[model samples]
Target: MAQKSEIEWTDATWNPVTGCTKIGPGCDHCYAERFAERWRGIPGHPYEQGFDLRVWPERLDQPKRWKKPRMIFVNSMSDLFHKEIPRKFIDQVFETMESAHWHVFQVLTKRSSLMRNYIRKRYSDRSVPSNIWLGVSVEDKPHASRIEHLKQINSPARFISFEPLLGPVGEIDLKDIAWAIVGGESGPQARPMAEEWVVEIRNLCERDEVEFFFKQWGGPRPKSGGRLLDGVEWNGFPWQMVPEPILERLAS
Candidate 1:
């Protein structure tokens, strides 16, 4: 993983754990899997075993080494709540996040139920730290239930990734959601995303006053079709939930 990232929304990526399995249609053309597998069997490569669900305890303390504050995308290459991962290892990850309060940790997962259940048990008596944002990946209408699972969490900094949006999400509530990111899929086998699909979610984000960001219109490449929706770039982000200390660091 890279300390600096090109992801339009986030400043950096921190992958203390890497590798994942395909759990849904969204995982069909995972860029991470493709990249990791290419280097499989090559001696000494980080992904030498390919995308086979591996954890790096040595990397657990990575975030603490970065003295400057950053928007760290936790596990950009894998799903943190993957059932294969041990609870003790996951606890270590959380401990680092809690200790490194200066940075904002964006934790996302396709395993919504697992994530919700874990969060509830971990912080049962208190609230999820504001600096640690929680979100889910939604690709189509059927998976919209993940949104409800995400809503059950007590975190205020909640968001959704309607990326590689395979189909329209239909009518769904955006209440309690702080941010929403919409984008088309990118890869050699990239699927076409209808303009109407983007508009439908954008309209809802407007209605609910949720910060909305249009990442890109995918093709063979991520920026192939550009990120314009009705002749404008939608770069909405939820700054209200950002802890003032982090904001102050960012401003400096």
Candidate 2:
């Protein structure tokens, strides 16, 4: 089931899978890990094993029950393409997305290699659903290459979520990318984000005409810092797959 998100970047969150191991710097102060720990000892807890990845087969049909159209952030508490998750299960997730056409599924993964491989091998014949948006997390320069890897995969909409912004990611090449989301880390041990870094990405997105969403100015407590940056809030979405007619209607 989808839960309303405090994350300014997405509307709602759906976690058919939960728990994940930290793979990169972005995982330093993981909100999901902390949330999972809170559920420890509860029977049937999705993250009973703490941060050890686990899939919930019963949760697969959750999206179908929603009667309203929504923007869903898939696997908010876990990585869908983690090595522990089987290919068959990934197919089931996709099948559910395919059947539920009203909801737009946004899946972001740090496991770009697995995501690229799975899509190329299993979903080659089947077209990516127009309502499904795929993205990769690029926390720093080392991880920026994942953006290139993301380009290799065929998706109706492709984007980047550069949240927990560890360092300056100057001049991202949004050649084939549809959207770019930027934000600093937030939590009890959050890091400081330089204003110039956000400006650089914002300028780059403008230059390339890519949709830009600035999430927050993260500090030790994101709520204390608030989401405002430079006196205004950024809440943009890359509606690349949205039909022109619909966009026209929305504009009106």
Candidate number achieving the greatest TM-score relative to the actual structure: 1
Residues 1-252 of candidate 2 have per-residue lDDT tens digits of 359887776668888888888889999889889878987877776656777788889999998998666678999999999898988899999999889887778999999988888888866887576778889998877888888889988875999998877888866688777888988887788888888878888888888877889887888766666667678887777776764543454455
lDDT of 1 by residue, 1-252 (tens): 557999999999998889999999999999999889999999999999899899999999999988899999999999999999999999999999999999999999999999999999999999999999999999999999999999999989999999889999999999999999999999999999999999999999999999999999999999999999999999999999999999999999
10 residues in a row with least lDDT, candidate 2: 243-252
- Prediction 1 TM-score vs. true: 0.99
Q: In model 1, which range of ten residues has the least summed lDDT?
A: 1-10
lDDT of each: 0.95, 0.82
